[model samples]
Target chain A: MPETIAAVSPAGLAPEAEVYTRAFARVAVERTDHEPSRIGTLRKAAIDRFGELGFPNRKLEEWRSTDVRAIATTTFSFEPSAELVSEADCARFRYDNTHELVFVNGAFRSDLSRLQELPDGVIISSLEQGWREHPELIEPHLGRHAKFDNHAFVALNTALHENGVFVFFPRNAVVETPIHILHLGRGGDSPVASFPRNLFVAEENSQGRIIEQFATAGDTDTGGNHFTCPVTEVVLAQNAVVDHYKLQRESTDAFHMATFQIYLGRSSNFSSHSISWGGGLVRNDVNAVLGGEGCEATLNGLYMVGGTQLVDNHMRVDHVAPHCDSHELFKGVLEGHARAVFNGRIFVHKGAQKTDAKQTNRNLLLSPTALVHSNPQLEIFADDVRCTHGSTVGRLDELGIFYLRSRGIGEEAARSLLTYAFCADIVQRIKDKSVRRDLEEFLFRRLPQGDVVRQAV
Target chain B: MSLLEIKNLHVGVKDAKILKGVDLTVNRGEVHAIMGPNGSGKSTLALVLAGRDTYEITEGEILYKGEDLLEVAPEERAREGLFLAFQYPVEIPGVSNVYFLKAALNAIRKHRGQEELDAMDFLTYVREKMALVKMDETLLNRPVNEGFSGGEKKRNEIFHMAVLDPVLAVLDETDSGLDIDALKIVADGVNSLRSEERAFIIITHYQRLLNYIVPDVVHVLLDGKIVRTGGKELALELEEKGYSWLEGEVHEEAVAHA
Candidate 1:
């Protein structure tokens, strides 16, 4: 109804046009019912902004490693799932000890969710409710953490997503239990696209943990293509602590594009761990801002890519305040024709003195054909900070294997042992017992054979 | 008949010979101490005997019990009762010490055609062995040799040797990093595991460890060949006289014997 929002004429473009001028027309009509009215206008504005800037290519330094042509040329229809998720199918993902929050097709399913009792001053509600009830609290920090201009996928997530989880902890509150939210992809027999967004705000001196899992419940071996576009933004207020984790295990034929943005206030501690297990082509964009002095941020991730899958995780940590510390460790195991790319960047601003940042990206190649590319970059503007970045791409240590075999461990067991060891450093740092146990078990089952481990994908 | 025999053993690494025409024989229940200066092929001999792939045998025949030992793989050789406590134990991260030892022990047991112990039984078995080395129960649950002190690493090796219960134990400079207290514990562990059916090759540079676990035969190795073979007192003589005493005639005698 707004005059600022424009609808492209049907004659101007096909329903599957590759370029934005024609493509936006189809996406606009297709996502009309799902996209909120206010955010839809904002999305149109952001699209116009991108049109002014144009698409970034290899010429842009940041886009050198990741090519957007493959994603840009792929025509994905904004279709929703026709078949609803069943209770029995959801049981497959249920953990023994977790407060489950189920989201099917980007909409919350209250019947499938099990919310435990919350302490005083804690709020867990839907973003749709927040948009109407807590507009002041939601509007200011909704899209403030991540820079939408840098990435098209995140911008698209912002424009189309209508429903998501909104979590907020009041000042000085300590919520001991971890909140688990499982996002299920359940659009059967058609090409479906979902945009699920999340916003978490930890008030001053508050403490909590959130575990987010994204899984696909469609035919993986069949040619059913599902597209999932997700965004999660977390804000840690002064002296607050947050442990955030995101698990992406979609159907092998699905396309998953996700973004995780976090902002830390003074003396706050924030840590995020991401695991990418399944997807036809998956890409994760994570950005964290160290906004205050003495803040600490840790980013840990493990990804296993196999077959023809292309999995990429691009992250940047901005050190804006002095005396801040950030530690990042990402491991990949790749096999078959799977390809993986990791680009981790640490930016130490001019005023961010006394900053200590350490980043390491390690990859293991199980197959000679599988490809892995890791680029850990450090941009230091301040002379007083200590920052180090390193990337290692190698096969399993032959001597270490021989040492184990000489002690009577079989070749298979020995290789698995060392591969587990390679990933243990990151997995051990996760504080949540249930989350850590689930991930460790998942990794153990998948470690011995996978493109992600073989190729360090 | 000897329990182990090495005939005309010639081993090399990267096309360079490290052990040349080395011949030795040991019967059951005997402990042979091979001593030499650093880089004088002491560790190389131990590695060659343990079937490490880093070295290729140009010409040799190693008879263990009866079959050819050189033809077997290192792990198979280990299954056949050959154990090597490395001079520098390799650190295996993520794999707990207890898990590694349990797998190793089970592999050995399977090779001996015995029933495998279950998880609880294996834990109990290792608990008793841990006490032999005075090792704490907590260390067993940790990553193998990760963040372990040098002495703890040596003690873990001996503890593993006890678990595997190998017929032939080769301790290569196991006492190098150990203090007097750690040395006594490790030596006591090795002594307790000793039996008439098991033979040991204690490889060391100094005679200090020999004072703790006295060997049946002490062989002074100079320039890849044994220059002298004597009793336990020979270690004390070597400690006092030093290898410099055997520079000229000892070298001549080794060459003549070869």
Candidate 2:
């Protein structure tokens, strides 16, 4: 692929950037009826921002370790194979008694989705449908928290995201069942690309849980390369409690880049678990902002990768209010020649006194060749705040292995048991029982003695 | 034939030799107590018997059930009915104790051409064995030895012994950190497991534990060699005189040979 510096502008642009720029124009012209809508203005501004920023190069501070040039120069067509998906393909991803909303190649599939009659104030639908039906509810919080002024990927997703899930609950609307949004990537004979946007809004005093997962639907290996770029935004009002889970297990031949942003109101409690069984190349940014006083946030993550896969997780938590507490725990387990990066930053503002924040990142390398880069940073401007951060990257516990081997477990089985044991604490922390079981299933699926582990654990 | 035979055994770590020219023999249905000071090689002998590879055996031959014990791997040694109750039991987080024991017992049973025990049978088996040490049922569901008290850890090792039912059991300082009551409980647990098919080598720093479970033979080890061998009365003698007297005797023997 040639770096076709499109003479469309003074500055040189890569093939993908140029292609997306042209695609954005065609989309803008096709939506002539949307000229007077706020979405039109948002898209226009996002496109302009994408044009200026282009795709991030290695020179940028954040993208220094993760190289995106492989996908940046390759030309990707927006039209992908809409592989015939049935209820069977979606069944494997469903947990017990969840309101599932399925998407195929970034297109909403109501046929595979199931949502029972919810309470009067709760709204869960496709963004395309929600925008058309409940514009009053979708207008205010769509692009408010996830700003796209400097982030090129977020800007591109904001401009071109076709469809995604929209979950909204008004004040005090309690939902008993979990809302699951499942995204399945379908590859074709050529490199295919899609942008999925998700928005979640929880009003005052509401309680709920959400599980957003990404996986491949059709022929994952034989099919050509698939690029999935997604951006998700969640807003929680005062006194609401929510538990969110994101499990990303894309095909190894695919590229997954995502941005998950969350906003919390006064005294609201929110927790998110981001599990990455990474694709070939993945860069996931999970950021949370505490905007009100007395709020609590728990952001935990686990990433396991093998082969030559590269997974980078960048996390940021902002303590903007007084009497707020935030906890971040991210762990990685790498095997083969896989490499992973973990960057956790906790930022406390000047006036945010009485802030309590903790961050920890641990990595276990199963093979001698595997590599991990872990960095946990704290930037506190408040005097009365308590903050601590720690990181570790090393091999599995040798004594633990010897203990098991001496107990009649073979060496291989001992390692597998200990490997799964390393992930058990995080799995046990999942508040949703079914989701925890599902995570357990995924964690053990790749292990050698999975049945033995399941039986033993 | 002896259940275990160690001839001219020497074990060392790095440049330091922990055991030198040690010779011992054990028969079935008998309990042997090995008494020594802190720096003696009692634990080294126990660990080497369990096939821990950290210690280098420069010149030694250990025969267990007429097979070269050094050639077998640790797990194979366990499967062949050899057990070691570690002085400091290893704490493994996230693996339940019940599951660990069941996997171990099934492995042993399978090696002996027996079928694996299902969960129901295993639970029944475990509850019956728990009574040997007065173990709490709640500890069975917790991680193996993690967050367990010192006494609980020792009792857990004995519980493992009862479940595994090994042919030769080596206890390494099981009574080091236990109170008198806990000591009696562990001794009772060990005594109840003694049968014609089983043998034991109990390593201890104190003679108080021997009061509860009297050994048929007592060996005094000094400077990596078994310097004295006697009946259970030797434990009472060591308790009355302490190890300094034994050291003085060995020193006088060395001087006389010189």
Candidate 3:
């Protein structure tokens, strides 16, 4: 390969780029004696791309609202491989009898994972392990769905990605239990950054459910301003069905930027639910493309922010084949000085006739200072397509509050009930009973007057 | 002692004086019907009694159970055994009927030093009271008054009155948008809740509802003040002769006083 490194100028790359460069050099030297691998080549190409692109600026249309200058300025070191996490740390998020893969600071922890009693043809393991054991099954679809050419964050993640969760469901296999992936970020004295890359593939005629959870360790002081940039790629083959969920509850001072790219085959069905509750600055980019005819996709998200938090959700659904349908619903509740942004776009190609797409974004501002910006767009070129989009930003209904209060419910309880009710529609869309119940409980406890509402209910 | 006493209550909404120096008193076991034309401040009286802040009580004194009612908040008033059946019931989309009623009952019970009922006990109590308005069981699980028809919403108000079982109930235009059958069912529900320790103030524009739930006294409210007070037969007389007769009588009284 030709030399791709340019001279470092005074204002060229960010302060954190030096750390990534040093880490990449160490990894390359360590793997020098090993056999030539496709992942190595991909990593080298990604590092070159990252060096050229750097971090996205505010002038970019996609990064207009979200500013990552703080992240670029802060020096974050890559966490070296270590056994820093314990089983007790993972106890709270574990579910019974379901397969789980745990990652601490972006490194897979096999000691804390439970993969017994998995169904036949179901592969649930760490990404590094999967690449070593079943490279044939992992190589063809690993980085194909999530293209990092244009996205600077995706490029940076691909360049620094080490170990994360990998799940595969073979053809004709149906998994009854959901696979859980826990990404736990831990920080010490210095700020740490983790690039977690996850790949999920459901072969033809298969069915599966994946729950990806991102959280920090206990206590706010422990995680000292860490950064988590995760990228997930999903592929659903012909006649396959998959339900994907991403629950992000990082530390209050953390920065979270995630990208989810999905591809749907012929007659395939895919749905993703992203619930963001914590983090100082969070932005999620979710895109789904219908590659074959008769495919269906559903994207739903809910974000609750308070106390100087900023959360943004940007989604795009592309109808590339005829007879494909996609639906999107995103709701947000913001309080204090928190702000939120929602941008949803639906595109129908010229040849993709009979496409049906609907998008809706609704936000509730709980305080006078809380604000939200919503933009819903539809770009349709097909003459025989039905596409509709809407956006709304409002406060809690005062009359509704008075109605509840007149019935002897306290003002605090009434307000909390209304807030919960505002997000209930999105919570009800989750198909798993346990997941829905857990999310409801989480929402109830997260609201301002949650205790009062919980007791009243 | 009277259950409620409004002495020269002067109320206004924004710039308009809706109720000008209205006086009324209601003792336990008495149903007082205040009939008036449109924009005559009948609904305003009910809302003011319910402690709604929309109306400005410029000069008034309202005593409920020997305590000042204006000093109380709306939720506190509800917990103090005072209920107001709204003319237009609000449709709260996410709160279920059962949950709202249970919360109201528990809040009131807690205020009265009574033990709160569990889910099972609450269901049993609610099932028995729901029959007062002949409400369907399916409606209990649905959101509070959401997508309910006008008649169904009126029936739900009455259902809430029956369930809450307040010491004093203010039914504001409860018979406005109801068919004959719904009117009868609602009137029956109201009658079933009447007791020697309970009082009711029914504000309406029509005398037809008084035929079903006979009131002890009939008061004609013209503009703001009460112009006439008579026995239950006064409603029939007002029905036979229209409200124009009362207006003429009020004008004659004013001329005679001048």
Candidate 4:
């Protein structure tokens, strides 16, 4: 790569995107990874779209509260690595009984990954191997759910994605245990950006759980100065039941932009938990479409941030058919100059009657300096639908604190206890016992008087 | 020494003054009743005594156990055996009632240089206090005061008063929203907790609560000042005859002074 290509913004694109444009051309010529020919056309279109849309600015209504100048201007390597960087200690985050898939620096590590004996009709492997072995299986649903026509980050991720995870469950396969994906971002001497992608396809009547945990190696507090752009697409066939959880615990200084696109068929019950507790500048776009009748979609998110961190969650639920239901509950807590934004919209398409949809977004500011912009919008084109949306932004309940303090608890303990209670609204909704327990343990460590909170709740 | 003393106490919120030039004294084992009309600062006095930060004490001093009570923090005040039964108990979701009381009790005990109670021991101790208020066992595991009926919130306040065992417990309009049956039950809860080592400063808008638990002294507060003081019969007189008569006498006194 020439130094001139990295220094200047090429043809009005951002300098950050310019580096990727030059790097993409080189990677495209010398690529050795295996994928279907359809992906090649998808990547070309995505790169062209990336050149056009560069990066989002505050002028856009969706990106007003969140500023992306640092992500657009900073130069990070788009490297493809075969050697493992850090020791990637992931023992503390493991669930008791489940298959594990490991990805280090956006590159799949088969030596570090594990899988149990699969029941028939279940497929789990790296997308690289999955495409190499069975391109037919990867062709139909590869870029189906999440298209990058309008989203720049999605386009950028689509153009430069490394081998991520590929999961397939044939019709009527009921697996008891969850599949855990641990993506670790380790700090090197210089900053690097990685685009990690995952594709999940479940056939009719299948039931299972999936957990995605993105974290820094060793859980260190500093030197995570990297960028991760990940896009995940999930397709659930009719009558498929799936519970998904995404825990984003990147390093405190890491930049993370993620997009989750999910589509549901008739009578499919899908629930997702999105938890973001770490990262410097983080933005997540979670979009779910109930495209078939009698589909139920539940989306719950919790974002707890402090210390000048900024987290933004953009959610959209589209009821595309009659008798479809969607429920969304998103909560955030911020302190110490931290800022958070929650923009949730429930769209009821024409003739989508009996489209029972509910959306709630609440934010708690622990410090006066912290701020939040909660926008919950509803767009209904149907005449007879039950759709409601509400949002609230407030500090910890002062009167409640006064009541607790008057009863002999210290003011600090009371505040921590109340904050825990506020977060429990979404935490308790997680159906998996092991996942919920790990989340509780992770949350308790961050709050003071942890023992009291452990006992009180 | 007196259990609590307030000399020429002047309290205010913002620029509006409340509890103007109020002086009072209470000894151990004495139950003093403060009866007043609406906006007469009965609730204000209770909150100020409990060290609520919303109120500013611009004049005079408060002494408890011969120490400056106003100098202590709210939690420190609670640990030093000061309790105020809130007029409107707060509903705190996700904090169970049993766990909240245990935490409160443990904090106070730690301040007294005593060891913390284990879960079983705390449960046993709290059950005894709950029985005094006739509280249902089901309410123990529910979030603190959340979705509680008006009567239940009042009983929970007294239940807390019994468990914390404060040296000076101020009941701030605890009988305002209770029915006749709930009022008697609350009064009985207060009566059972009375002893020689503790005192009660019961503030009420009506004297009906005084019938169940007779006060050692009754004081009528009007327009931010205690205008009259008497024995238990004063409550009876005010119950039969309304506060308008007392307001008349206060107006005459003010005119004479002017």
Candidate 5:
């Protein structure tokens, strides 16, 4: 266990910390009868840890470039339910023929969820219900994969999370259709905050795909300021394969942070796609651990930020066993006064020989005011490791633009075509045709000059 | 009127002059070959005619279809049916060949007040042009010229010209890196595209390409000026004697004029 700072009183903490302390106190008193339960005990330990460490500051090396001081000092009250969200607002993100699980304000809404004709050996339910019905499967993997001792937001989420999605794929079960979990944040009359927690477990020889998306309601005038902290834990057994995609489309005034912890067993394959397009201040922490030999992991991310938004993606792939391979590519397009940061780390342990790792981070700034900080690092304790990392920050390719224009494409349309081409490789990597098409349309709609290219082409 | 005309055109790059005084005229239904040693401004003239912004037109005028061509933008020039097969074709990594050609075709068609072709019609048209250059069908789905071999890139340029069907096609050393087979294919494609309404300006250092696509007229360029103009026999003469004979003639002429 990592050492924790001394716990301080509510008055001595920051405003946001005080709010969390008060919220945890109320929840702790309400569940006094269930104090002896395992979840209750975990919650108490997590709240205690949160009180000890408060919120991470820029003093820590990991938090040096990404300062959460503004988020930590803002006072936001916990809202168990939001009243303004409608079914229409959620319909825009729905796909065809998939199991849909919806959560509003961090609370499960069975009326808004659709789960029909699931295959055998598959369980899809809310976390609270999963714990009640399938404790044997949920208890062993819930908080075990995601360690909260060193992460303040994870600890905070573990303590205050009300309900989120729970997925379990038993041995040898292959899910053909994807499972979509939509977490909608709707602000009420006052500033609100919610902690969403997810647990995913795939047994041996199982294959599955999961899409976890977060968004806000359409009306901005009624939606007050809010903060969202989510934590997801994934455990893959031997020979299991899973593809997980997370799309964050929060409101412009919202502060969102999420931590995803993934563990891969022997010969398991896991791929993660993290696409972020909204939120005023957003941070994503994705860490994968290859616990067995011959495990393969691929991480890809694309962030499009404009206005005053700030987005950060911090990823780590740990190779603990030999013959494990990991590939990561994270790209960003920043405009206006927006800023972005990508820090990718790969670690090969002492016995993790024959480890092959490649990491790349590229950023395209559309404006002079936009900025990006990309750092790709590798730490190899083994001798026979093939590791490579690179990063680039620049504008659109001028020659490519000229080449397009010389073909009779307008100047603005040429710029848009080149920018879309820059992002085409990452989009082409998605296996699902429908999802890839939808994402392509969504990204193209956000471009400043995509309209012209769309009309001409 | 001549289809294209250049009257005492003087162009420069920054401070140095590239083309001192170049005068040329090409009528419809004719093929003109410009033969010169390296750095004789053959490629520069092609770039300037295609409206590349790198070179400044210090003095003189260029007339395309009896209009002031210098006042037009690069894309406008392209829309006006001026095509330049680049000396070094650019490799665009993510724009597919089919999509790029379709976009360019539609833009030019719209400028010419013609209806745009649908996907089916466009593919049909493109497939026909692709066959003319003997190009593989798989190359159409790939990004523009990306990962193509030297010969493939040159073939792709001629393939594009075949699809666009430009009125004035400028071939700038199209045979530089091509093998004999590829050079034959390119020449055949250019030959098939020739018509009474179209013309070509084939710029080359080697006279070997002229053997395949015989030129109606050949101009020998020296020191940014057309030193001599003759019939197709001049290309065969230059091929046998090399550029040294022409260089000696130009030196003698300059000495006698002085």
Candidate 6:
């Protein structure tokens, strides 16, 4: 494979110098290979903005609690993977009921994917194809969900993404089966970087679910530097419904940052769930804008981290229209010396009367060294809204643990069961059964022993 | 030989004595009922026996199957054939009842050098046990004790006991919220598990349960200690006269002895 990450470098960005240097080189090579077009201009603008800002430091507002100094120093490279993932690797990330769209190292891997029957009026294809055939569809929604100037990672993702899946469900057409997207990043012995972008549009009265997963291609514990910056946008028309799930399980040396923007039309229902189990420095920026009247939005997340890994989930539910309701729940289980950040905010606009918004963030630190920073904020401009927000950080209830152990469950098993149960509330919200099962299994097998020291102790 | 023996066992929680100088013994094939009003330490003894860490064993020894029970952790005590049916079984929202029961059973079986049961075998075994308790099949598939009615939760507890096949089962107020019909079903489930090598300490507040699952020995606990011991008929007596009468009698006896 032609090395792109080594060709380009960024000079003198003190805090994010290392990550910028690595990302700049990788972005240069990947962008060079892409067919330039009108959409490419917008993506390029995002990249330039990112280059100017670099990765956010502690000085940034949204990144205060989540510092990515480690990401800045990591020696990683990007470009596409040279190795081919065998059929066995494909089987490792399969979902039973849904059609799989596999992207290896940010490029769509056709050999590893199975695209099945689609209902009429439903458009499903790679982002590269969408750019050429349906340029109008990708123009308005791309980079529209995230703020380019404020988010360095968001800008970086827009600038360098080579290929991703694009899904469009036309008016009144409901796709019962979920659309599954698997993004596998294999760093191997050297640095690897990928920018995976996904855009989903549900027209009026349309309903669907999108399940996206990111992980390393094969099972090796090599701590090579890697970064996956992903951007996903969900646009719902009047009375539309969209359920989205993002699963991030990368190598420990990998840096993952994703922005999920959801737009709800009049009377629409949108739900977004994210489970973070891997990544060295992971940050997820999720925003749901209830644009139409009587729209409903639900944001749920569960993050399980161990080792020295840092996982952060930031959520904002903007209640723009009256008679809208939005609920956000985020829970975390931190073991070892792992640290997690949960910041959930609910914003009720002035004219958005009768808005009902609720937000809750709960953290269970199993080890004393396990650190969790939970911040729940509510900004209400209207007086006639019922808005409540709560943030709690504590260890698992001793009484609950004792109750489980008294019933014959071993201590370790009891702890595991309780932690799973704590996160299961959010996992069950996933409408897709196979996706939920896959997540449950991943959380069980890989979550046990990873961190250096127990954080909750 | 006694299946469970607690001699001069004293336990407390957060420096407050809950089980003070309590002495009890239950032989195999016998049912012992510990009846007391709320705050009388009947539940504390059960928790202490189950090796719950909340109740610190300040001074005393608990011998179960001739082993120092207090020295064992809660899970170890469970592996040693000990089970506690919680008065309010925790509602684990994501863990199905069958999964939790199978895990408990497997842990006990592995402790006893028995092979683990795979999915098919566990389903069959648990289905049969669930039928014994007349529990709804839906409850077994749902998360452990979650969304269960009062009686359903109690019956699920007994079903777990039936699966674990513990040598000593401690039912902490298992009959507290059950109707007569549900109580009969739970009593029958416990009766079927009774064997020559197993014993039960059924904790309850009312004598109505003792009517269905007749106890060989009845112990009256008050103020963190077993103040009086009697036959099964004593439950009927206490039910009629009320525990206040027993407290008066114990106080009189203590004064006279002093």
Off by over 4 Å in 2: A1-10, A28-36, A219-224
DockQ score for model 3 = 0.55
lDDT of 3 by residue, A322-346 (tens): 9999999999999999989898989
lDDT of 1 by residue, A1-457 (tens): 1211122223532222235544556665455453346666777765655444343456555556555554555565454442377687678777656667888878778888887888886877777767766767777788767666656567667666657888989899988878889888864555567778899999999998889988876453453567788888999999999988888888877788788889999999998898887887788888999998999999989987788888888889999999999999999988888888899999999999999999988898878998987888889999899998899888888778777777876677667778777877777777777767777777766766432122211
Expressed between 0 and 1, the share of native interface contacts present in candidate 4 is 0.69
DockQ of each: 0.40, 0.71, 0.55, 0.68, 0.49, 0.37
Residue-by-residue lDDT tens digits, candidate 2, B1-258 = 999999999989999998998999999998999999988999889989998888999998999998899999998998998999989888877788999888888888989999999999999999999999999999999988989999999999999999999999999999998999999999999999999999999999999999988899999988899999999999999999999999999899999999
lDDT of 5: 0.85
lDDT of 4 by residue, A247-318 (tens): 988888899999999999999999999999888999999999999899999999999999989999999998
lDDT of 2 by residue, A1-457 (tens): 0121122246655456778889888754464352237777888899877777778776666777788877887778776455556777677887768889998878788888899889888999998888877888878888887888867789988888878889998899999889998988866656778888899999999989999888887554543467889999999999999999988878887888899999999999999998888488998898899989999999988888999889999998999999999998888899999989888889999999999999999899999999988888899999999999999988878777777777788887888888888877788788888777777887678888776677677
Model 5 interface DockQ: 0.49
Best by DockQ: 2
Show model 1 residue runs off by greater than 4 Å: A1-38, A50-59, A68-70, A186-190, A218-224, A449-457, B250-258
Chain B TM-score for each model? 0.95, 0.98, 0.98, 0.98, 0.98, 0.97
What value of lDDT does candidate 2 attain over all alpha carbons? Answer: 0.86
* Docking level for model 6: acceptable
Tell how far residue A199 is off in model 3, in angstroms. Answer: 1.0
Docking class of 3: medium
Backbone clash pairs for candidate 2 read: none
What digit string (tens of lDDT, one per residue) describes model 5 on residues A332-383? 9888999998989999999999999999999999999998988888999999
